[model samples]
Target chain A: MTIRSVAIIGLGLLGGSIGLAIREKLSEVTTTGFDADADVRGRATANGLVGAVCDTAAQAVASADLVILCVPVGAMGDAARGLAGCLKEGAIVSDVGSSKRSVVSALEEALPDAIVIPAHPVAGTERSGPDAGFATLFEGRWCILTPPKNADTDAVSALTLFWQELGATVELMDPDHHDLVLAVTSHIPHLIAYTIVGTASDLEDVTRGEVIKYSAGGFRDFTRIAASDPVMWRDVFLNNRDAVLEMLGRFTEDLTAMQRAIRDGDGDRLLEIFSRTRAIRQAILEQGQDVAKPDFGRGSKEV
Target chain B: MTIRSVAIIGLGLLGGSIGLAIREKLSEVTTTGFDADADVRGRATANGLVGAVCDTAAQAVASADLVILCVPVGAMGDAARGLAGCLKEGAIVSDVGSSKRSVVSALEEALPDAIVIPAHPVAGTERSGPDAGFATLFEGRWCILTPPKNADTDAVSALTLFWQELGATVELMDPDHHDLVLAVTSHIPHLIAYTIVGTASDLEDVTRGEVIKYSAGGFRDFTRIAASDPVMWRDVFLNNRDAVLEMLGRFTEDLTAMQRAIRDGDGDRLLEIFSRTRAIRQAILEQGQDVAKPDFGRGSKEV
Candidate 1:
């Protein structure tokens, strides 16, 4: 594979950003993105995120060495099926879906004759659209690849280098393991956020207004997470239902215990749990995942 | 009564910040603060957050024209009764407790002859202690005041002026209304945060480790919320039980609906509700309650 051309399907935040990242990393690579929405393709080209806006998925991947699928998780199988025939004989196919097991399995069955590699670039924001994409979006973020056991080593190496060149540190894991890790890290957290923010949205009109007014205290954080792309998240929860619900059950049980502690005025138990959680925040800071200061160094010189 | 001297009891984050705000805004006021922890009193005086440090609540309240109780909600009653006799004649007392109804009721019943008003500064951070105090902490924030029905008008005016001078936009409301408002905004949010973090804290060791590693996506937000002053939040949920439970019931019901929608693959319904919440984020931005950027404008400007 000469690897001179790349096709990115879905010119939303992830795909558009990948287009920019790849272009920045490999100047010789001619990137073409095809979005189902013409406006997205138009915007991606206008923003210089893609060198060319392919007229169709087949047109984009017609002569590319790598074809990327960055759509909603639920749409992966259909997209894989659509591109199965158009993809070059030995070209590598990958996705940036949050989940892995089901997506990989579906892509495998949908494109039995094509080599599909499932990779998740663990970076993003609540914002979507081509305008929200940026080249350095993947800096210092992890990108996990879950390739089938029988997949070609050369194809995997090529895919790894492609993501690594975009400023992501690549890691390989079993598809099932990737799903489990994400369920714990990303999916469950988002579910809880959506649930809490939804809870506030249902309050009596007066209280709902107050919740919005004073959200910066804590609830606002949940609202930001809850505000993530709903179609994408809904598909994630539905596809990863068993895992999300399982983790949610654990969460609710723990919540119920805390509720009881509050009711019983068990300050010791509350403080103990708070102390443990604070240590986790410290660990996140140590790992460079979060800032040590409350303002996260952004408001270092605030008004 | 000439307002020459003021007493700030409990000298922690809220008390120290109040001392700083008062001293910075009121040049004529000579402020003294006392804390159960000797080190807090020493630090407050040494750091110049207060004009003086006293060994006892009685010592601090004696001869002061006004007294402000900035302790945990659970201790408001004790602080109220303890200073009743020691407070100078005609001295006005107020608090910065989060739960207005409980604190007001407690203070009214415990110190019938003393002037008491309950207030909440709708601002703070996860960090506590005297060193965390800042004069700007209350700036651009709302200080919700809950004065009793038969409260002295002059006393209310003086306190309102005090907060306004500290750069807060003070609003007056009934104590019950204040409680209801906070139940939706502060108390309910903290309860959810504590519950979610407790959930993550109890996960299997391997999964728990990964949760910390990848927390930046969303869980990190909840962790910061959950890491709030534990004692303060425990008292909030317990004292405002009726309102919090009511709001919690509404929230649980809403969450059930969201879960059902996701389980059934109802993308439109999820999108509608999630989209609605995005407007709330926008409102927070417009109102200057929260910034519009992710990671709260942390991370690199380009990334």
Candidate 2:
């Protein structure tokens, strides 16, 4: 069940990274990539993001044993539909969308004859587009596969092994559960970051210059997250609405309680919550989910 | 008005960094430090965080021309009061608290005769304690000085020069304005981060292990901020109540709008807000407040 050829649809951060990762870690496997944007296609070709930069999505998936749709979740259906008659007879169709439930449904609806195993490699940076990606982007990261009920086991195993070879730890989870987990762990966080960064930008009392200057006080961190791909995030919120809203409700309620504590001068209550959150960070570092160095070691390298 | 001798009242992250920075940049300036906790005092001595780690706050400030209180905002009053009888007649008293108005009042009230020029080095890491300090922590970071009205000009210039010598760019700001500005830039961001991390930890649908495992998706950034010193944050909320609440109200309104957009499937509105926030990140990078590299350059260094 080894993947002989991989096709990446949409040469953005995720797509370009997948192409480059395949070239670097799975050099023996043939890689081809395509983007709707001709400029991106030109850049991808120039950067050698893939072994071949195809003119169309259909051309990319024609010879691929594994076809991964790497566009925004909202565009997954179109991306999948474009490959309807072009994909190899046994091609396993997959995607690297943030949310899994909608993506799985979209791919299944579009590619009725092709095998679809939706996966989300939980890795990214704030930057996007063809030049923003690197070969090592997926290394040491998690890639959750959400195979449909009673799907082909061999196809799933091949995809898992492919991701593993690209330096990712693979996990299998239900599509619904993956959406809910990502809602809390990823979606809501990005939403909150976007909201706060906007809030700071629109302030009447504080100038944008001031916010930018004193950003080291803590605001800079949110700016990085808030700077992530807008179209990708917009589609994420639309596709994972229920889970995102549910997580947002919980976050808003907790934030309300914290606001009340601040207004009421409940130092003890504030201390309790603040104290407990540190343990979660410790666990994250212990599991190697994040680096333990201060300010993500930004001080040493940049400053 | 060259500051010949300086005393640091709390030998934690901010205090210890100040001491080390002084040693590295202004080697001839005598530096003495004291922490309420004897263990921290011992660590300060062992680490050579200052020229002398005094046993008492009074002993630390006896002959110093300047005194900087580096304790939590809630403890600034007591720390200043401890130095009342021992400070030199014309010694300038300052602090490194997040919020400035309350700190200015607390220091002025506790040391009526002292030249109080409260300053906040808008720089730090989540890591705290005596051993967490480093000489370059303030390098190229902003330090806002909120000196009292009619304060000695020479003393203010000397204090500003002192921060500059430590590799920080200093700016003068009104205490109240500083509080309001910091509420958006630091306090509210921290409160939201703490709230989200807490919410994620308490979710029944999402396991803590899952949250940690998938943190790199975006949640881990909030966790780094949430891991900041709890007592310090607790005091920040308590002291900067009005500004934080005001900013929180605006943030809540914006978040509510985003929630409604998601609920109504308004992709255009979501994209607009998400798109605009990227400009702020660009401004932050252009100002040298944050690194231009992706993921704060974490990928190249640690992973």
| Backbone atom clashes (below 3 Å) for every candidate | 0, 0
**Cand. 1 TM to true fold:** 0.93
Which residue pairs in candidate 1 have backbone atoms (N, alpha carbon, C) closer than 3 angstroms, thus clashing?
A: none
Runs off by more than 4 Å, candidate 1:
A1-4, A25-28, A205-207, A295-303, B1-5, B23-28
Candidate 1 interface RMSD value? 2.2
Q: State the weakest 10-residue window (summed lDDT) of model 1 chain A.
A: A294-303
The true-structure Cα RMSD of candidate 2 reads: 1.3
List, residue by residue over B1-303, the lDDT tens digit for candidate 2.
Answer: 889999999999999989988998898999999999999999999999999998888889989998999999999998888777888888889889999888888888888888899999988999899989889888889899998789899999999999999898999999999999999999988999999999999988789999999998999999999999999999999999999999999999999999999999999999999999999899888888877666655543323
In model 1, the Cα lDDT at residue A274 comes to 66
Summarize candidate 1's per-residue lDDT along A1-303 as a digit string, tens digits.
457788899999999889888888889999887888888877887898888898889988887888889899989988888886788777778899988888988888988888778899888888888898878788777788999998888889888888888887788988777776777778888876777776666666556667777765666667777778888887787788777777777876777777677667677887777666777777776777666564443212232
B202-291 per-residue lDDT for model 1 (tens digits): 767336777776676677777777777777776777788777777777776776787687678777887777667776766776776766
Point out where model 2 deviates above 4 Å.
A300-303, B299-303
**i-RMS, every candidate?**
2.2, 1.5
Quick one: best DockQ, which candidate? Answer: 2
DockQ of each: 0.54, 0.77
